[model samples]
Target: MTLTIFSFISFTGQKSKFSDIIKSKMYFKTKLKKIPLSLVKQENTFFYFTDENPYYFNLLKSSIAKLGILNPIMVQPFEKKYYRVISGFRRLQIAKELGFTFIPARILRENLSPSEILTAVLLSHPHPLSLTEKVRIVRIMKDLGISTSQICTRFGSFLEIQSPHLLEKYIRLSNYTPSVLSYISTHGLSLNQALAFENLSSEEQNLLISLGTCLSLKGYDFCNILKVLKEIETKEEKNVAAILKETEILNVSKDVKLTRSQKIDKIKKILKMKRYP
Candidate 1:
């Protein structure tokens, strides 16, 4: 087991959004060691993004098989004689699959707070975060008792959100069901588009999702459909589910003969008539 010590430092004469965290008096050292894979727990607390690209996964697997692990995974001591992963989850997973008994790791010697560990993980993350990842981070930090103002100030650059109000909107996404959140992330829906479902019941939300899947609705079309539904519900004094259950909309949704575009267009025309009449 090779051991090496490294110190954490901030660049001099430079300001950072995480200045509060970087300038803190608390400093900890990390050492590189060969830790047994069994002793390392495969858990992630901060990172939420998953690379679903099969080609990328295959490429990574091939690279690891050929070159072995080029970088050390970061882990912290957990339970007794066990280490919990903080970063390099994918590498660790690939290492396990490749039947490696021991893997290189940078082990944190001192026990740090959750926020500190999260900061370290975020700082070391190499790729741009996805929208879902940003939302998950904001939600996690808020749950850790970090004030909204502090989060906005510290993470605004990292999250690519400069406005506190906008950050709050992202935070509110936590109220959505997991399926709804997944739909929002998969469809690349904007904040306003996702939040349009806020007033909907779970059943109504699910219905809309089913409809969207059946019609292959794009983000803009989905939002427009939601707008039409809300207007119709208001004018007709019925909920979205009730409006959707009407024969015309229901038939159009169930019509296998109609192409996705044709179905969406027919539904839009029917909704417009209901909303206007």
Candidate 2:
């Protein structure tokens, strides 16, 4: 990704707010250069499992195919012959598909620690990131000796996270099963909804995914369904499949005539009308 110039000029021998203090110490002087595409390797360890944003990737690939890459990717030297990509993964991938041998990049100076490289990645991305990406970054920071409090303090506003308390929630989200996580990624599962699913056994989580697909559940509907299911489980102390047999939710979800909202509404009414005794 293009490492755009960020102004840290205020910290140059002038008194600044406490917030700027930590950021001031972490600046890297980057230089723009053209690096061979073959030399840059995609490293998986930098972040947790993140799904490709196909919409963005396609749009980017199409754009680069026409106008060429408007911005450079970020890289740091790995071995004597290869460099590792820190950001702009999609751009690099698309560039390769377009049959280009080299791409523009800003190569960081040598001996930068993993934390520093990660910090630069966090700072250099121009747009808001996906939740998985955020989780990945936090997971890596924790891996590299940065505390959650420090990460929230320094990058919270930039990441658009509500609070430091929520950091743990995202970290927990990172541990979800890949299938469930993929569903979460596709359906845009909210924090509460994801946590709700986390309380389930692995089998139930998979069932939830199946149930969601059958119903074509929206975000609000998904949360509501989970809430009702959770309440029923708590009240009756039964697993999800047993509870599902108690209502027509599965059958109702399969009906093509009803809209998603109508499905959720019907399911809720059914759950509310039934008694577990």
Candidate 3:
């Protein structure tokens, strides 16, 4: 198999600018070598805290088949015989499935700590990493005893997280129950929605999940309905299952003529009346 390698070129007047760019954390030595795919192990910190999305796997496969991997997978020596994958897990998986015996890989420098390796992987990823993947990175950083403030200072702006508390919120998601995580993943729940759902009792959550499945609510509608159910449960001292069956909330949700926004508004209004009356 032919190995693809990356290198930096110096332009006449752009030399200084390129040098400065290389000095930034975002720039790394891109040179790569082709190594036996079987020698590389998927032992990166990212594998621990999140599940892979099969949809993304297929997308990656198609991209690789057409365009080939634009970036080299990062790896480091491990156990003196094997290399550990630091980033590009999905790409590696797809490459193997495509019957590639050897893969392009960049070997990370020696003596880096786990946190540093994790940081390098995060900064070097070619594709935009998912929020859940990032959360798992932060959780690992936390496990390595990095302070929340330090993490924010280093990655907050890049990850678009505004505050240390907000970063903490993402990290906490790693500790949510498996069923809840599965629900969040399968339904494509946003971070805000997951955070809201995380606060409910397991029973309340299961009922809400059932309600979503039953009504065939999609995307934001499912989240909004859950939020409404949560509000009514809090104020009216009722369970979600009871509210769905005993009240007209589910009926509002299933109404064919109402737009999704209208349904959300109606559900909120009905919940308010239940709380007040």
Candidate 4:
């Protein structure tokens, strides 16, 4: 048997070549048919963004606003000159809002590979990320010799949940109005904050978002404010003015649990330290 095995090994230039062929036959096969932009079609392309697309939205509207547009919205070109946006709805709307006529897009030139389809998916959706996620993304992009945009387009954006406490706020906003998500996307609402509002009961979120709907009321952190509103039975009972006064929290306060009487003492102690220390 040993002599036979040696003969077989000698007959083959390299045993590894046989193994490679077998291994290659069992791999996954997924590819996109890259139809030309003219072949592909576009319809109803300019829709306001929705919260449902967890892949496209990020935590900070400010970041998106600051970054401007890095990647052009993707579209399948159809009928020669027209095309449908396969991804980047938010980008398209913002560009429209920002006043631009022609947006950048990629038309299919050849049959897309499985990897290319996956890359398009990665581009379209990004996961929520925290500061650490951003760092990890940067590192991965560096190691892979790719840009953040490329990685994001190929892989979903992985985000860290930065603020859990304000989840209800996002929910409330969504409940308050249908346009709440778009408002958050357009305004400077944070992703965690938007998600927080989204978590609220539909009715409650709509109510809260409606109340906070002015274009000027951009930074609507919903949690405590919504709580204060709910604490009062009716909108009339919710002294909106007085609540706004209380809405201001010293962001750097040392929070401590205390009974009513203990709370009084704690405040006194805080004041003394503030004045003296």
Candidate 5:
């Protein structure tokens, strides 16, 4: 993708809060000034490609087509005339598609480690991870021999996690089917939402994919969630059958008639309407 430059919204707006989050999470609280998009730069080493990444070419094309770069991309200064994308692969790709020569970016200094840069990028430009992204981050960390504590520390604090146990489930998601994983990515499913599919058989995982959609239980609380789900497995095949009985809502309840297509429809409808009703 090419570089882009669009209007920069303030840090108080919904679009702006993520930039604030990046500042708060990274503990880098400078007066974040809004600048014209022209000063922003793009770097070459910011992304590693795989056909598997949803932020690959197609979605990148679509995001640019629809959002018109709704969110500013992240960047780190490189040399005299370039910036690296810490995140916002879609924005970058779209910029290229839209024929933009420059894009909005947050300029970071040249000397940050990969993890630091990623953490900065996440803090600066978070997309509220799909279960797949969260799992991928966990896997990325473990494979690279990076500790969660370090990621947590650099990202700001491990304490901010509402469900720390999610770290465990995230690492395990790599074991699942690619199709199953794609369902999460396609739907913007979060770690918590993915747990709704957990303790489920492969067949159940498929069912949950159909049931959950891009709406229902956008994500789950992996820590408190899976723990309670494990405890609720009073039947054979806790991996599958257990979810047939009870369901965790906020890691609190295990009883809900969420089966059947109609019920799934209702669940998805209610997901965004209320606060975990």
Candidate 6:
């Protein structure tokens, strides 16, 4: 019911610098109101910030179902009659699923720039974000014409990224297949390990994903496997998929008798032998 101009300056400490950047670039008024679900567009405009994990979705749904929406979803006016979601995408989805005709929303004017909308969305979440979320954010910002330097300088501290090179890694990750990205997110794959697959063909990536899943690979083992594969690829001048197929790594991956450790050990041995021999 109350309309107020959001202030970025209110956020202090490390966020104060980030707030200053947003404050200098954009300003928009937001109104707290109950908007009809029909008037709100279901499509996500700032989906980079959204958490796609089913477990988290169910948890959020349960919380909303029990307590109702304690916080208003943020939206921006769209197509004269409808509103696009800037943040709280999960909340909006859950609200619609629960058959709520009207949900509480903080509506921004249609004139807000993409950067402004994105900043508001980013500010909506005060807590730390997941690696996948940070990756997507950098990607989206880059896509919006923000330079990598600006992204690192403005968001690096807030995102807890230490350097521009690390931020660039996140940018590169945006180009990976959804399956690879999802695997990296769920498996806790290091940035280095994930980027190692960047040069691989789609088929090669798929093979590695299958191998990783079969072997239950993570951390150092995964990195070492990639290293060995690259070495073999370089010496033999063969693609990873071809190397894997030739060495029967796929079959080894599927073998029921071999334990995970045994499979990994055998696979590594095969790779080393192929590279050396």
By lDDT, the best candidate is: 6
Question: Which should have the higher lDDT, number 1 or number 5?
Answer: 1
Query: Which ranges in model 2 have alpha carbons more than 4 Å from their true place?
Result: 1-30, 41-45, 48-51, 245-277
Best by the TM-score measure: 6
Q: What are the per-residue Cα lDDT tens digits for candidate 5 across 107-210?
A: 55566556555555444443454446556555655665666554444321221332446456665675667677776676565655655555567765664554
| Model 4 alpha-carbon drift over 4 Å, by segment | 1-41, 44-73, 77-82, 87-105, 109-118, 121-178, 195-201, 218-221, 233-277
Rank by TM-score (best first): 6, 1, 2, 3, 5, 4
Shift of residue 36 alpha carbon in model 4, Å:
12
Clashes of 1: 0
TM-score of each: 0.76, 0.75, 0.67, 0.35, 0.45, 0.81
Q: What lDDT, from 0 to 1, does candidate 4 have?
A: 0.40
Worst 10 residues of 5 by lDDT: 1-10
Q: lDDT winner between 2 and 3, please give it.
A: 2
lDDT of each: 0.72, 0.68, 0.65, 0.40, 0.49, 0.74
Q: List the residue pairs that clash in candidate 2.
A: 1-73, 1-74
Question: What tens digits encode model 3's per-residue C-alpha lDDT throughout 1-277?
Answer: 0000011211121223333332343433445678899898655644354456678678879999888776777777878868887766776888888888888877776576665565455445444556666666666767878677766665565556648678878877867666667667767777877786666677777766665654555568777666667777888788777887788666766788987667767776776677677
What candidate 1 gets wrong by more than 4 Å, as runs, is 1-34, 42-72, 97-104, 247-256
* Clash numbers, per candidate: 0, 2, 0, 37, 13, 0
lDDT of 6 by residue, 1-277 (tens): 0111223222222544554433333433444678899887656665455446788789889999999898888777767788877777778889989988988877766776677777666766656787777887877887888777766555655676647778778888888877888778767887777787788899999998898888878857878888888888888898889988999988998999999888888888898889888
Measured with C-alpha atoms, the lDDT of residue 103 in candidate 2 is 90
Q: After best superposition, candidate 5 residue 208: deviation in angstroms?
A: 12
Q: List the residue pairs that clash in candidate 6.
A: none
lDDT digits (tens) for residues 168-215 of candidate 1: 888888667777877877677877788887879999999988887777
